[model samples]
Target: MKKLSPEILEKLKGIKAVVFDVDGVLTDGKITYDNKGMEFKSFNVKDGQIIKHLRKNNILTGVITGRDSRVVRNRCEELKIDFHHHGIEDKFNVFFKEMSRRNIAADQVAYIGDDINDLPVLRIVGLSATPADGHYKVKEEVDLVLSSEGGKGAVRELADLILEATGTYDLILKKQ
Candidate 1:
């Protein structure tokens, strides 16, 4: 994990919600399909593990992706994410709507995305992040560039940062 500067820490402290872009941010931007048209995407358990803590701490989590897949939906369900919207062409609009619905301000949300399509929401969010292997443009636009690559603990890294900043990580560890 990269060191968090005071400014970044402050931003993380205000993050009441964290939204993710699925393909490159959650998976490794890879998709595999069998001859029978079955699709597969691998997600990191480390990433999934942190969501429970986030929820326990009352931090909202969501997924918004341009592509729809049963696998992704299943993962979101398993994680008990507060929101999940797939096949979204206009991500910013959907994100804005969700934020409004939940009464969460834009400045209280953090978003992680790895592609150009994610720009609209990333740019507007209070804290924007991307994986180490994210597209160059996305890396440039994001507030934090994670040390881990996609599907290999990038989301966990971000979640850990948020937990640490919010002082939830220590509390969780003490309960262990």
Candidate 2:
């Protein structure tokens, strides 16, 4: 992980929720379909574990993606992430609505995105992050760009950073 500046750490330390984009942020930005029209998406096991850890520690987490898929829904269900909003034309609307419904302020949210469509919510969130292989513009706009590419532990890296910033990573590790 890169050394985070004091300002960035301060922002991350305050994040109570973490939202993600699906296509690029959760997967490798690839969409595969069989001749029968069944779609397949690959996810990182490490990332899934980190998400579970975040939930265990009482940090809110969810997904907001432009595309909808049963695979994503199944994954979120397995992770027990109830705040996901998929197949939305306007991601910012879902972000805002979900946050408002949960009574979470913008400054307490961290949004991880990887494309142009993610820019709106990323811009307004407290800590905006992207994968190393994210879109050029998205990378340029993010506060933290992980060394790991999407679907290859990027979310795990972010989860570790967030836990570390809030002084919970070590505690969690000790307990485990």
TM-score of each: 0.98, 0.97
lDDT of 1 by residue, 30-73 (tens): 99999999999999999999988998999999999999999999
> Which candidate number maximizes TM-score?
1
Q: For model 2, give the 10-residue run with minimal summed lDDT.
A: 1-10
Give the per-residue Cα lDDT of candidate 1 at 165. Answer: 90
Best by lDDT: 1
Candidate 2 positional error at 86, Å: 1.0
Q: Give the alpha-carbon lDDT of every model.
A: 0.94, 0.91
Q: Which ten contiguous residues of candidate 1 have the minimum total lDDT?
A: 1-10
Q: What's the lDDT for candidate 1?
A: 0.94
Instruction: In candidate 2, list every pair of residues with a backbone clash.
Output: none
lDDT of 2 at 163: 93
Steric clashes per prediction = 0, 0
